[model samples]
Target: MSTTSNPYRGFRYPAEIINQAVWLYHYFSLSLREVELILAARGIVVSYETIREWSLRFGRTYANSLKRRRPRPGDKWFLDEVFVRIRGKLHYLWRAVDQQGNVLDVLVQSRRNKTAAKRFFRKLLKGLYYVPRVIVTDKLGSYRAAKREILPGIEHRQSRYLNNRCEVSHQPTRRRECHMRRFKSVRQAQQFLATHTRIHNHFQLRRHRLTASEHRAARDHAFVAWRDATGTALIG
Candidate 1:
């Protein structure tokens, strides 16, 4: 919960109604109406508009909850971008991922120019105690400029195939976009992507890299951390 005062204090719905609304709308990639329909199916009647209001009011709260739960970003980062359409126009999503491919931060902006690129770089660089060597990125000129400016020294390379690792990591975002029918606005895209990235990092285990039993153990441990962090998701 935010340290800010509650705007919903004067509202009619109960707190759980708001929380559940945000949860369903976010966790399932559901539209406000879809969340209402899903809950109605479970005998909880609520209007889609109500769900929308809840989502707008509580989306940050939900994101904050997951942020507090998420593990710190790992070292050795890869960077990439994906094309997205926001309000019938083109936009780019800049993302940073750790060596394990856990998304560290996400930014949605109108252009991938130096200014936008600098903003994205700052977002990733903030809160980091150490610098990552071997920064991987595409042939984008903006990345070249920004990397040279902000991260002067470490080994920044522009290999063609080197960034394929980050490119492949965009698969989940693409998969989820099909369900969302595309994001309506930049704000919505940023909010949803930020929360989604954190959630994805929480569940992503190096299953393919580990043996079956080892993978299972890693997954179980990740789930335990998730449960403890959220104070939900019973381990038994």
Candidate 2:
């Protein structure tokens, strides 16, 4: 339990309700209305609009708190970019993940050129304490150009198959995109995906690699971490 000041101070709802609402929205592909109905089923009468407001206000706060508690990321980084149509306009979604499939960062840009690649590289390095040992990407020449200037000493592997980890990681974004009926703006897409990746990845234990009991333990640990991140663990 923590002695820190309450994050839920002044809110109409208690920390537990807010925490559960935020968790449900991010941990699954559920909409705000879906979360509202779920809460209503439990006798909690909250509107979907309020749920949306809570998500917009508190999602990133919780995500950043969780990021501070994660262990150092893996040294092998996989970078990839995919085109997303926002409001019928094209935008690039840049993503980086470590070897273990943990998302490092995500950037939404208008181009996949060298400048965009360089910017994404800088964003990744700015958050990390150490440079990666290696970076894998598809045959994107911008990555090669960016790496030469930004990560001169690290190994860069360009292959269509070597970076499947990052490519597969895009599936969740795609699913969410479809669920949301497509993103309305670049900023909205970036903000939602940035927070979504952190919170979703926090609970994404690779159950296939763990025994049944181990999976349960990992899930319990994830819940505890979520509690700590959202300041709900401090609640008596």
Candidate 3:
């Protein structure tokens, strides 16, 4: 077990157990019970239910911590939405990513109308300082209107391939969604995606055209930022 100071002091599980639980959650797309079982075989006698609590309570907290210290996302933005099942119905996830595949923001909504689009844009512009030079989206009228209302001077491109960057960005979320059988509430889906976005941005290496060493260095640098921001180990 790790000898590090326990962040959740007096909790039955040690830092090692919590670390392992979080690791499994991020790396293996493991559910809380799966994390408990994985650790149980290794002789850590924690419960699946507690693991779930740890993840929900701490996961969002940790992810937010990492985001605070992460570098500002690049200015070339790609935006899109994906459908998530909530209570056997469809909910939309609005996602924003930078040119280098860094996730910027994620918003969940019951509708995809102009108001929904505006809300998503508000979240995206919250922490960002400089405006993106290019905002890429599909042929969505709401996005076009939101662009005009919020970021008037920003160049909005409604091209086919331009949004491939963000469309592909949802793959990890989709993978995780498959595990939970889908969210029961829109709020739950929103919360999970928000955390996942920060986690993804923390670890994503802009692996395009870089040498192995450069990629490693970039990843290491990102982790350092994550640690400084969140005060948690980059367990993945």
Candidate 4:
């Protein structure tokens, strides 16, 4: 059996329930208790704590599976950073996304200096098969400094208006942070957001840009991909 088939081997609850619970929590701004209540309304009596455990254990696994299945990221990369307050300590969330709005990666760090920027660049390029043709960012000197050392040959565009795509991408993270009453720690924030972005972006069809039938087709394709990632066999 494939390794994907083994993740829920010892779990008592069915894989469907676990998959649905994790999906509801991460794909939406729902809390663990909210997910518990949603499942309870469907006659499943799982506790919020159990749901939390499920998320921590299996969320990254599912996300990785989906990432492996996604198409190659766009060559035009847009990078941005936003401050996140965890327990009154300010940290920066460095995020990279493609021109198509696909999240490339995210890193949470204590600083936004050149060192932090270089670290984020390295993380972003770690698994990428090809380097980006152009990197766009706001007028941040760190990006300029880091790009010189890390991505020396790539084009770097610095403009506030041109980077709105990356800036807008941060809105979802902000919403999720508020919904969770802010993350408890740096590690927690990093782990959760890493999984959250992948899963969230997977299902985020550009409906406005797609026709209704095209939208439905994209959504159905997304569901099929989700089932494959979760190792949930289709029901006849």
Candidate 5:
């Protein structure tokens, strides 16, 4: 097992509170002040600014630790891109997920042209260090042009309906964008979304496909894994 050392050095609050604060912010489409309100309701008084600091500090660490424990991604990858507003300008958020709905990677770029598509494709493949058997994407000409240059050997399927898995995956990000009133900058959107995807993936159990007992067991397992990943036991 790959162990992650605690990154919460010299922190006044316990690791549990810190982890929970980060979790509530990333795992849900809640704002910093909203998280503060929620924690206050539970009798744990903490400022929203502090919560933001904790998120910026420990969010990436926790996400990286969780990624280390994730299973190898499925062979069929679904790729998609959506426009996000940053500082009143448009940027493209490129994302990929496997057949099992496991997020492979995300990238924010200024354009959605052939060059942008190629860059995002390379980044996703390089980060994973593995090639997919097939890639499903919308009928974006840039995708075809980019795929030919990047991984021509891989099968590419183009159909808007066939790529529903990736389309559905963007809903959470859309919700988060609304909650934050749109991202302030491209870098900020990339950082927050990257961390958010990992944490969301960790807890997304597809409960609809599970029996009640199985759902409970799966949820408990996810929490245990989260505790291990954050190196903090959540206390009631």
Candidate 6:
């Protein structure tokens, strides 16, 4: 396991408390105030604003740590984009997931045109390193146009229901949107969703495929990974 330098150097609280507060915020669909309430219930007197700062400060850093520890993405990639409302303006959230539902990358953009598609493709390529054996997407003309320009050789499959895996992946974002009363800005949506996806992917072990004992073991393993990723175990 690779070690991450501690990022909690000057924080007044211990690493465990700071990591727990951030975990509660992103690991679940709870608002900052809601997280504050839960911590208050536990006799911890952290304010909502402080929790917000901690999430903003540590969320993406921790998410990147977790992503680094993840296995290589599947050879077959599923790509999709969904519309999100940011302060009443429409924006696109482009996401890619592997066959087993591991999130590869996410981008928020103002358009879903060919240019937007190409931009997302570039981001995915720069991050994932390896080229996919095949790409699956819905019947979006922009996808075909982008693929033709950027990844001409890879197989591109498109159908109405062919990319159900990517479609189903949007459910968690929808739930989070409703909980937060919609995102305040595009950057906020992008940042939160990026962190949210990684945290979700870590614990979403597809329980139906596992026995009860296996599921419990998987959850425990994920918790240990979370601790390592968040620097809680390392510091405390």
- Assess every candidate by TM-score: 0.77, 0.98, 0.88, 0.97, 0.95, 0.96
Worst 10 residues of 6 by lDDT: 1-10
> In model 2, what is the error at residue 229, expressed in angstroms?
0.4
| Residue runs of model 5 more than 4 Å from their true location after superposition | 1-5, 233-236
Q: Give the TM-score of candidate 3.
A: 0.88
- Backbone collisions counted per model: 0, 0, 0, 0, 0, 0
Candidate models: Cα lDDT each: 0.74, 0.93, 0.78, 0.92, 0.90, 0.90
| Local accuracy of candidate 1 as per-residue lDDT tens digits, 1-236 | 43344445687866655655665665555667788888889788889987777766666655666666666767677888889998789999988887778777788999999998889888877746567876888888998899889888868878778888688777778877888789989988988788766656566676778999998998888756644443333212
lDDT of each residue in 1-236, candidate 5, tens digit only = 13344456688888889999999999988899999999999999999999999999889888988888788999999999999989999899999999989898899999999999999988987778899999999999999999999998999999989999998999999999998899998889989999999999889999889999999999999999899888875332
lDDT of 6: 0.90
Error of 2 at 23 (Å): 0.7
| Rank by TM-score (best first) | 2, 4, 6, 5, 3, 1
Q: Which run of 10 residues does model 5 get worst, by summed lDDT?
A: 1-10
Q: How many Å off is the CA of 76 in candidate 3?
A: 1.1
Q: What is the descending lDDT order?
A: 2, 4, 5, 6, 3, 1
Overall local distance difference test of candidate 3: 0.78
Candidate 3, residues 1-85, lDDT tens digits: the string is 1125445667776655675576467656778778777888998888888877877877787777776666677889999988877
Q: Alpha carbon lDDT of residue 14, candidate 1?
A: 61
Q: Comparing 1 and 2 by TM-score, which wins? A: 2
Model 1 residue 96 distance off true place after TM-score fit, in angstroms: 0.7
Q: Model 6 segments beyond 4 Å from truth? A: 1-5
- The sequence of per-residue lDDT tens digits that candidate 4 reaches over residues 1-236 is 13534667788998899999999999999989999999999999999999999999989988988999999999999999999999999999999999999999999999999999999999988967678999999999999999999999999999989998988999989999999999999999999999999999999998999999999999999999999888886431
Query: Could you tell me which residue pairs clash in candidate 6?
Result: none
